[model samples]
Target: MRELLYQINEHLKTVTFIIIRDNNDKSEAISDYNIITLKFDDIIKSVEELKLDFQRYEDSASKLAELIPRAEKPFKNEVDELKSLSIYNSNLFAHYYSNTLCNNAFNERKIVNNSIFHLITFRSIVNKSKSNIYSLVNCIKDTLFANWSFKNQGEDNPLCIEFNKPIRYYRIGNRNEEYIVADAALFNFFFDFKKALNKEQDEDIINCSSDDNDSDGSYTSYDVSRESSYENNHCKQIECQTFLFIPRKRKKRAKNDPCKDPVKTIQCYFRSKTHKLHIQFPNNNEPEQELKKSKKKFYKKIKNKVEEYKIEKQSTICPEMKKLLDEIENDINKEFENIKYKYENMN
Candidate 1:
């Protein structure tokens, strides 16, 4: 998957016009909006260079790993022999990987930590591209919904048509604004991971600063104890954190109401869970038993899918790195809950 993502990134960097339009329209003229220039040969060379560089990093990291007891050595060459390949100058890759390896020479963990570092860095890259991805998706959506009536383009276009619905106002940062709810949800998702990473990085910096100060024998026993306690608690949290359970919030309905419907209740539940479902419980009525049934059904469905997915993709991820990912995912889930609560209350 990482290799595939790297390939996709390279492809995106090279011949980079991605659009959704009429298949019959063969006008391949370059547009200012969606165009990037790079030869396929250059892309192959870049990948080859990356592979070579990856091996070098692996070897370097492995040698450094030998310095720490119980540290696993990094994976060796995964590169294929490719002739006449030139190195691509990528400061982002160099800077990130270099810092990941050299950030702390005294790190007790290196290879596994490096993998986790790479995973987070990958996520950061993908998060950065979310806006472009969103735009692409919107373009595809618009094309799919297009009436293609050039006679009255704006009037005929399905995308230009707007419908009224319940308004939900939410605050993001200092801005009190109204926008697509999904955009707000994605913003929260992106913000949570970034915020947690920033917080952790800041904490590490503070700890290093404190360690430097303490080397001069200015550290108190209480300060050491407090830091140790915090570290212990954090370790425990990571060890115990595997699954996150987020409860669904529902409005209270009157008891024994015949108007309550199970089908609409299930629909609403799924709709709230994901925007993919366009189910609407317009009556806003559901029996308590049916709601419970819906909750159980939802839980079971997710559990099965998660179990299958875990088994299929589990081998690539290191267990130690998986723990770190789980911790971050749990944090994101909590952040989502908080955002949901605030949004609901505002509505």
Candidate 2:
């Protein structure tokens, strides 16, 4: 509770630039009053007296707002200045009261009560409907969207979670049975897709496949950068290296890597059951393919490539490759120790 009050007080300091007139009609900054530390004693007592619910929070928020004195004239009669001031105030409120910037705020606690209200309210509505299950799910989606919108009111890039497309609800069971059914894929959509863009230091593979939408596992990577819209907002295309291999179960690769070979010439796979690391190289290629290099040469090539890329630590070129290499080398050293013991025992 002390921390919350401290946070509120800290935030209040920034918005205390509101100009107000004193008893002598002399203009002075609101900061001169030293009202930065917001005392919530009265509000807390009021809330303690009332029932703990959405109505209580609503009343509390209104009272809290009343505590912050509004300047009759924050700026001169210039329209642009007024507009800019309004934006600044809105941003401050949005950052603290709304989830536009983050979810940690006093209003977020209020939203919890709102969510409970929505759930109970929708439960009654769903009970009256003929299709209970489907109606309940639809209500849940509606509640989530309502909360999402309420929290992100003043956000510039508000991310929305919804079905990829409208689901075609069909009647399930016999005609006499009143039950609506939709594909299970609808529920899977929320988790399988991501709307957030990857940052530069992000270690995740960039998936850049333009074509091949229906994941049959024949993956390929290409240098394609484009802009596309989702929910009417323009989003840059995913540039992660493994964006093409979404449906394929594969290990992570370096980001923005120059190598785009479909077939991995050198790869490491962990054999948990055997306690071993399987290092496959170009020499292990089947179908009697032409040998690019001997095993020693291939090992040298891999070593040189790792050194050339400076894959000793996490960097922009390959953030996660160093950790992966370390794990592989650790296992390899363990196996070498076992081999050396066996050789010594035989001698």
Candidate 3:
């Protein structure tokens, strides 16, 4: 997966047009409008086009897994191999084996290996691209939605577009203003749970650890207790931690009312009972269920996916992958410098 992302990053660097460099001096300054029209505009479009490729890669790889036999063949491997070659023809068998099938007669293993390979490859590409693209998008939003005072009545107020939604007003640093954030993100930026819990002076929290299972993993395990007498599974308890359940807001509806016709597929961040941020996204096609049960189930689903992603990120970062990524980024930086020089010289 890292290799595939490295490949995609290298490919993007070769495009030679997305680079933006500082133009601080008046003589060297590129017009903001030009920068927007070129860099920002092209980046947004490129991400969309790249998204198609990512999806295609995943689908193609999934199909590739199908080339392996649907079920395991426990008989003589030579007989199965010979039959496949004779029936599918030597050239076709060679192609299929090279692309998908392998000496492992275990169908499930073969399918899992191929499918996972492709899934990780495409996911890594999109994951890397989305982060960079969203950063640019946020910059555009901040610039277009910064705090503005209506001095001249005729002056236009800046506008911010929240994804596919209509243009809306935003006040910089204003928390009271209702804002929409629909990030198709994989994980939550864990809002410091301790800070959220420790905001007030009156509340107290307890922290604890023991001899088994939790030697290294240390996080703000919320003070989920009303009294100091509360003891954890492990007997020890330390002080100063506190938290309360933060119920997710929902529209007022009848107890029997079908889960408000499932909202659009969007990833949102919410404060959890433990005071940490968690991502939530409901599968739109899922059948409606009782509100509380349905929501709790969906929240767990999102949390599990985020945990898997973090594990993948950690395990996939080998020395070779790191070297490859460094090389690719170096090439990208070089291309960026070349483009910057060319653009400035031309201007």
Candidate 4:
């Protein structure tokens, strides 16, 4: 709760900015002082309350998306398709009204609630009826897209997951090396290795091929320079070096009932042509007394530091915003002058 309060303090400014920029069209700006002060408390609370259900939806959505095609007619596995769809739709209430962005400050919570509601019910998107295979396939495509979009919102590239290391590597790594693989390939559209453009796509392509999208594995490192949208939005780390290689399995497999169907294990391999990265971290060892401090005391100190940082950061709010606005205005003026200069010279 204390950590959340700290976040509320940090995010309150962004919420205020959103209201300010978006609320300007309202002619009664002077009378709208109340609208200018926005609080993300309710929004955060609502999100936290439903966070678990949203997570479950994501998991089931992935499962249904992977198997929807096989479950459709001709294959006639309607049981799986319908059951998965039922699971998906049942959770739709979790994000019931998600399509529209909140344009009104008065209804900010509504907008946020709707957006989050829409974000997690990610798989229900479809076009046309699911009557025929063509339509069903098309609709399935839509479902896949929605699921992908919600989870990997900022990813610009579209591609499937491919394996870097094969089955043997994962098997050996898991049992022997204490490194395991994911049940499925997960495409982390939020691939944030700052490098040449081509390599970024190269990086994500390998991730798209997983059976379970979110799994942990082995690490290798690569050089990281600038932070990408993924890092800035999600991670606070300044450097990057290693990546985990997770092994994936067949999406469709036999269920329990060993007498009828034998269990299967996914193969793992180490021979991946894609290069491995060598990760490094500085060993900033603390003093013995500091290291020996109680966790509660350390946490309190860190909390105080974070609070102080927020307090200091609040002072920069106006100046920083002014600087950005000035830059934009200057750029506009420069563009206008350049065009005028060109025209005058040409005449």
Which predicted model would earn the best lDDT? Answer: 1
lDDT of 2: 0.29
Model 2, which residues run further than 4 Å from truth?
Answer: 1-104, 111-347
Candidate 2 structure quality by residue, lDDT tens digits, 38-85:
233432222222211112222223332322222223211122222233
Tell me each candidate's TM-score.
Answer: 0.18, 0.16, 0.17, 0.18
The TM-score measured for candidate 1 stands at: 0.18
Clashes of each: 0, 7, 2, 28
Worst 10 residues of 3 by lDDT: 1-10
For candidate 3, write residues 1-347 as lDDT tens digits. 00000001121222111111223332322334212222323433443333222222222333333333333343234334434433234222122222222222233343344555475475554344334433433343333223221112221332221122111223435442222211222011011222222333222223332223423322222224332525553323332223322222122323321112111111111112111101121222111111212335444543454456468764423454344334433443444345435444644
- lDDT of all the models against the reference? 0.31, 0.29, 0.29, 0.28
The deviation in Å at residue 293 for candidate 1 is 35
How accurate locally is residue 119 in candidate 2, as Cα lDDT from 0 to 100? 62
Which wins on TM-score, candidate 3 or candidate 4?
4
Clashing pairs in 1: none
Those runs of model 4 whose alpha carbons end farther than 4 Å from true positions after fitting are 1-38, 71-347
Q: Which 10-residue window in model 2 sums to the lowest lDDT? A: 1-10
